[model samples]
Target: MSDNQNLLAGQRRALILDEVRRRGGVRVSELTRMLRVSDMTVRRDLDALARQGMLEKVHGGAVPVPEGRTHEPGFEAKSALETSAKYAIARAAAGFAAPGGAVALSGGTTTYAVAQQLVEVAELTVVTNSVRVADVFHTAPRPAEGGPARPATVVLTGGVRTPSDALVGPVADAAIAALHFDVLFLGVHGLSEGAGLSTPNLAEAETNRHFIRSARRVVLVADHTKWGVTGLSSFAALEQVDVLVTDSGLEPEARRVLAERVPELIIADAEEE
Candidate 1:
């Protein structure tokens, strides 16, 4: 009877988790009715799931935990945020990619934006750690109407993938160490005077360090929203940043401080239509 109870409890919690993920949130009372369990039992299940990091318990019930310093969000979730700002930042950063020069692009929505524009650069070589970014080049349209076909050569690193779709770990770090680039376009989960550049994934931070060392110039591409948000791991310091490209939403104080620390700061117009 005890074993059966344990199995039933496990199945109930699984159902509760599925409901929370699907509906975005769930009420304890509703869950009790749906599962035909007591309110206290539903509460216990919610508490267990929360402790296991599967969901977050709120006032009435439970919801998904918002991505925090340690909680990394998936690519789809992040890509939907700061759309115009990322595009603007990417446009400004892509200008630094010289034709015929080697460029390294770190994984993030903003860097993925940069990859889209780089497809037009003639004879460029791009090294990247994001499979999604690599796919941008891999699926780029062929030269139009028999025009000169000069697609940039893309080198993708191999490693374990993070929730944000970044390839990290020793394999990625080692791959980046073996090569060098003229410039590196890095996108971060957060940037600040203290944290500098950071990501929630520790392996990605280490891999990003390798990228910074392998490039002559490091241009950090991020939107204004990332200014003060610190992540679990930091990769580079402010003094190491050669340039920063961001949108107009950045505060004046942030701009002043960043301009003082970074060599150059470029603000792009991010007005959406």
Candidate 2:
């Protein structure tokens, strides 16, 4: 190819990466039209990017690569670490639920907080992979005297359990695939600009991704400590996130970046009683 052609290809590829970063993923067809290039050329660009470990080529698009190392702590351990923040975040997220709504909760301490607050919501169908979360509704009653018990039904996924109390694998996937949710209250091991929403265990990541797709809206409940850490597998990115409810502990600069990427970012005041 001539110098100009080479320069144009490089520029187009750069633009594609930029688009993916901003929107989480970019389709081959969209890139072709945006670049004024042929479909074959767009695929070649994606192929090149994929080869460099910059992105992963999916069915018709590419997503960013996960950055940094990530690990998971047991459920009880994490629950003790961020008691107030999780409570605050959970309260904020629980407010989103409506009566008779189907809400899915992925296994995480923050989400367990959400589940705790959710007991006030009457008749909500709660699907979860965590035994602890499911137990919240086992015997919940409204605050009123002899008030009616929360008619909420908790569906626990059938799968192998993790130390974090998350059930994952084929059984969980199949169960999640058959159900749909009005909103998904998700918990992640970490969130960074590069890695997006990630988890330490590969199976949990897969289960989380399935939950993400099963819901119409994704509401993330996380604390600031999740900002820098990364996980082994990333299930979604800012583009995929519809709402993020985090704690005030997040750094200023991280909030700025998240605001730019996520459509709705709510930094819950964990300190407020």
Candidate 3:
């Protein structure tokens, strides 16, 4: 109401924006402490920013506006963007697989990396649409301590191919409907608190949705850059995922929101490589 009060509110909002920009996300409690503002004040500021299209407001915080989420990159291009981060996430995600159980993998560079790690798995039933991903298991042999190792069974979904090498269409969707998996690993173009799990291709989104339904437990593998981007179509929500394996490049604020919203959060540190 007063001149100084207005100035303080303006300054606090500016700081809030800066913090979210730097960390990709921010929590209300942390913002209150950092900005020395009341709970109501923080919410009001976040709401204002959200209305301005500057950020997306989540359960307890805000994430910076995801840029280029609607843009789909080719497989080769994406694989080169975050090589180290993808490897770390892949390894972490592969640990979730049950040795003899079935697993469904979506198309993406990160998921492909996960599949590569899965080549070591002696026995696994893998269902996927990516040619490269399926090849990893079929071509690579798993060494066994005794006699011959049981080969991993890879079921390829038939459908139209995209720039990212994902198979999608009525065919792919139908294949997913007929089978159930122990776990599903989904890789998306971008993740936003509001949009949930999203991708640039509509057909891929449709196909990925069935993968979510086929598996009782779903895990999302993505790098930090995927946080703010909201793809053109959303396949799953943040709460729908059973586990998330991401790289340490994620901001602390984003990490906090994930820990609060999701059941489990695993940050794959690249230093282990």
True-vs-predicted CA distance for residue 218, candidate 3, Å: 0.4
Per-residue lDDT of model 3, residues 20-98, tens digit only: 8778898999987776657998999899777766678999999976657466767764654567789999999998887
Q: For candidate 1, list the clashing residue pairs, or say none.
A: none
Of 2 and 3, which scores higher on TM-score?
3
Scanning candidate 2 in windows of ten residues, the lowest lDDT window is 1-10
Question: What's the CA error at residue 20 for candidate 3, in Å?
Answer: 21
Residue runs of model 2 more than 4 Å from their true location after superposition: 1-70, 142-149
Best by lDDT: 1
TM-score of each: 0.76, 0.72, 0.73
* Each candidate's clash count: 0, 1, 1
Residue 145's lDDT within candidate 2 is: 68
Model 1 root mean square deviation, Cα atoms: 10.1
lDDT of 3 at 203: 92
How accurate locally is residue 11 in candidate 3, as Cα lDDT from 0 to 100? 58
Candidate 1 vs candidate 3, TM-score winner: 1
**Regions of candidate 3 where Cα sits further than 4 Å from its true position:** 1-69, 142-150
